[model samples]
Target: MPPRSAPTARQRRLGAELRKLRDSVGLSSTEAALRLKITQSRLSAIEGGRYGVSAERVRAFARLYDCRDAALVDALAGMTAPRRRNWWEEYRELLPAGLLDLAELEHHARTIRTAQVTHLPGLLQTVDYARTIFRQTIPELPPPMVEYRTSHRIKRQQVFWAHPPKPYSATIHEAALRMRFGGRQITREQLAHIVTMSERDHVTVRVIPFEAGSFPGAGQTVLYAEGTVPQLDTVQLDTEHGSEQLHSNAQLDKYRTFLDRFEAIALTPSASRGFINQILKAL
Candidate 1:
């Protein structure tokens, strides 16, 4: 098959797992390709996410690598299955590629956790709030591009409306709750929506008040998407340029610790609800 010019995060992750398996087993590319009856170039293409891996190939790699985790192998095979075009594809030309990839990742997430220091989480932002945030972009954006991004962000919240909703945990700092984006009314509505969302059994919203005291990594926004297995988990960070994804075991571990620390200092769901109410009252 011809190689893809651009691969999604899911595709790259499958390829990374394949390479990880080979590395864990201490097999050189040439040696593994010879054992699997394939060329080194093809293996490299698959590992680099330039080639689409077939289900058969995924299993073959599992068998050759001496991996006996039936669940992990099945999960990998599922990734190899033909994928339908997601909603994000509709705006592929309008939004940044990283933003599109983020939408796709959120669509497939089983469990989502996030920590926000300033801006509200994208998945929970209201339309007006999102538009205001977009308008505030440094150097400013063209009206059309701002509209496109605002619409794209609003649509991303649909994950909460899935047939069987995925579990979502958000740790929002007190400062973000008081930002007043789009003025007091818009920010109030956004906070209300967050409160309503938290009432669901699958959703939890916690507040990290200024009174929480000191903590590490307080200046970052983190969205952790948990996959079927821990090995497939991903951590995404928003930057001035674009989205950055982290999947290496070390990177994942570090972010996991960040979430743990922040979550520890956050208010419980009930308290968080009351906290939002207090903020709304002040507004």
Candidate 2:
């Protein structure tokens, strides 16, 4: 099959995991390719995520690498299945590739955790609140483009509505809840929506009040997407240019600690709901 011109982050991640397995066994790319009975170029393409890999091939590679973690092997093999048409595909030509990758990541995540400082989590933002934020884009998006993104952001909330809904936790700062993105009315609606969503059985919203004061990751917005296996967890950070995905063991560990720290100071679910309602009432 012809190589993909631009593989999604998921595709790249699968390749990276395979590469990790090979490296862990101390096999050079050339030696590994020779053992697999494929050309070095073919192995290169697969490792670069430019070529497709089948589930059988993934299992074969795991065996060749002498990997003993059956669960990790199974999870890696699972990622090699045929790609299905997902709702995010419609925006493939319109939005930044990172945005689509993010939706894809959330779609497959076993659990989703987010840390937001100045803005409410995208999945919890109301339509008007999302549209209002989009309008303030640096270059200033065209009206239609703004609408597209707003709708896309709203559509991403589907994860919360799915059967066996995905578990979602948000660690939000008091500043975010009070941002007033679309002025008072929109902010009020957004906070109310957050309260309502947090009440879901699978959703958790914890607020870090101003009294918490001077914490780590104060200005950062992060999303931690848990995979079927711990080895596959991914951390995504919002940057000025685009989304940055990190999955190295160290990176994963660091962000996990960050989330833990955030949660350490955050209000309990009941108290958070009351905090949000307090802000809503003041508005």
Give the candidate number with the greatest lDDT.
Answer: 2
TM-score, prediction 2: 0.98
TM-score per candidate, chains pooled: 0.97, 0.98
What is the lDDT for 73 in model 1? 92
Candidate 1 residue 117 Cα shift, in angstroms, is 0.9
What's the lDDT for residue 220 in model 1?
82
Model 1 stretches with alpha carbons more than 4 Å out: none
lDDT of 2 at 152: 92
- Give, for candidate 1, the lowest lDDT window spanning 10 residues: 212-221
Off by over 4 Å in 2: none
**Ten-residue region with minimum lDDT total, candidate 2:** 212-221
**lDDT, candidate 1, 1-283, per-residue tens:** 7898888888988999999999999999999999988899999989988899889989999999999999899888989877688888889888789999899889888899999999999999988899999998887999999999999998888998898988999999999999988887898899999999889999999998999987669588899999888888899999998899899999999999999998998999899999999999888
